[model samples]
Target: MSARPRPLMAALALAAVTSLALGAAPAVAKAPAGDEFAHPDLKKTYEATKKYESEQAAIDDGYVRTDDCVEDPELGGMGYHYVNPDHIGSTDPTKPAAVLYAPDHKTGKRELVALEWVVPNTGQPRPRLFDHDFDGPFDFEPVGPHYSLHAWIFKKNPKGVFTPYNPRVHCTPCTEDHAKPDEPKPAHPKS
Candidate 1:
């Protein structure tokens, strides 16, 4: 009779211990640090592009080259921002095209996104300049949970006017944090 009671107590004790163990476990771990997603190569790309821009600026004060390397704050520290070159209008500096990414608004996490440059041609070399008739109203799309991609179709010079070429897509995360508070905005916008 005592043995039977002892076994029942042991079972009860085991159940209690199991419950305690599970209860002590955490529901979620903290997000990784900044170094976790550090892309040295991307940083190098940014620096090199900046240097080129500076040199070009020195060459001609009026000469402004559009680059795809702008830092986006909305990505919550996962990727950087870039320009959408396909949207340039007739070499118009005022209407330069670009695409930027950051983090999702709902969750403070970076995501893979992209900006597509839809022009009238295809398969052109890099650094394709845009003209007035350049048919492009680029579309930006998200790639993965933490990467933005870009694709462009440009027109070739000389003969091809409306030929479709260069359908390229590349992905990169927007490693920045651009989130506003969830509170309602005031009647007047803050200066």
Candidate 2:
């Protein structure tokens, strides 16, 4: 009888422990380390993006009769527009290479989420471009000729409408010399 009660108590204790473990909130995954964009940089970018979004919202509300309609292109294009967040670039790999935190025009709030790099060819008259995507806690590799970084923040509106706010930051121009490090030539911007 004593053994039976002991086993039952043990079983109840095990069940309680299991319930507690299951009920606990899951731990958040840690962001990657050693990435050029660190936590502080990300925070700054997010703030800038939010500011840009607020500016856009003010413009939209003041200038346009309807939120969806554009009043005049000459005054400025209609609808919600987000300005690119300010960003400082660094050659160091451990620091944030670029940061973009923009607000959702519809929601009027800042959302910090993702970053994108756009590379354009200076030699071409047309807008030829290349794009690279990165999430937080990861390293970003510089690629293409004259690459520009654009950071996107995701936000949701009152109606649960989600949109991305994109702010652009220009990086140091990539020249042919960067691609072919062994060769050195004229200092003029790459054609």
Candidate 3:
């Protein structure tokens, strides 16, 4: 028998009740069409995020960052993301932390377009980012084995932030204006 024994059952029950209460919360928001930055009371977050000159600056404010060197084969690249260290595994959404995004492929330009709240897995408590039982808004993702939720509080996302991926968000550097350098050209067929 595990040292904790049946404590897991009690913890699970508490999580279930917490999730139910959160589900009844002012429902996850919907992004306005063409206005991906539209979210209620998001202006404050936008303003706060804008103060940071770069991802490093955000990191200076206790934002933990995770970055991938190369771009994802399909999605191209959006530099990296910074999450608040304090809220990494906490369930309090009172001040909902912001997830700063850098879309310049490591060019150092980042934006505050979304908010994220995560719950770490350490016998603390499981998060309730979903509406249905055991189902989460971002069920496939985990932060340090913890559950997480996002809100595009700063930028306008046709795909609501509460949902997994934002449809309107794109790899800015992948655009023709910011195209990759010296890409291989296709050979012409003999006419």
Candidate 4:
């Protein structure tokens, strides 16, 4: 068989590198099964937040534990949200406003599940990611009005990554009232 030319191979390699640099690579190439459609931006989110796979890393970096494991009666659970008030309203990938963790039944510990971007609704343009609008502008109790987007980088969500809830996630039924939102922390002023 005739050999392919080196020039052609080089061009193909360059194209692939360029595509990745421009964020045009296929999203979720290594994502869990059923999660291949996740947006390319999710790769960025994952890289930025993976450092917080240990919950303590998150707390040390200013993410406060919300008392609730947020769930929906119909949609499913979003797990426990540890929110960093300072990161709110920011779009920088490294500054996710929240980290989500779900209890691992096998290990009996919380495992990292997702990263969330939250922006207060104060008349600014709504935040967008994963090719979808952040969900809300709904009054979120003490937090007031805001919009949020979730990237399920660590867990597979058959419903799609940007969806606010994850059926795969669950919360242990608390013997007491351990699941409730504390008085909402005000979002930091946008820098």
- TM-scores, each model vs. reference: 0.18, 0.22, 0.47, 0.68
Model 1 Cα lDDT, one tens digit per residue, 44-138: 32332222222222122222222222222321111123333333222322222322233333444322222222222223422232322333322
Q: Which residue runs of candidate 3 sit more than 4 Å off their true CA positions?
A: 1-57, 69-79, 94-98, 104-108, 121-144, 175-191
Total backbone collisions for each predicted model = 36, 8, 5, 0
Greater-lDDT candidate between 1 and 4: 4
**Least lDDT summed over 10 consecutive residues: which range in candidate 3?**
18-27
Better lDDT candidate (1, 3): 3
lDDT of 4 by residue, 1-191 (tens): 11111221232233233221111122222445553436666666666677677776776677765545665534557777776767877777678877887877666666778877777789988887667787766554445666777777787776777667766676754323433467443221110
Residue 39, model 4: Cα distance from true site in angstroms: 2.2
The candidate, 1 or 4, that scores higher on TM-score is 4
The parts of candidate 4 lying over 4 Å away from their true place are 1-37, 173-191
- Candidates ranked by lDDT, best first? 4, 3, 2, 1
The parts of candidate 1 lying over 4 Å away from their true place are 1-44, 48-97, 103-191
Expressed as tens digits, the lDDT of each residue in 63-104 for candidate 3 is 555542212333322223454545555444443443545453
TM-score winner between candidates 1 and 2: 2
Local error of candidate 3 at residue 178 (angstroms): 13
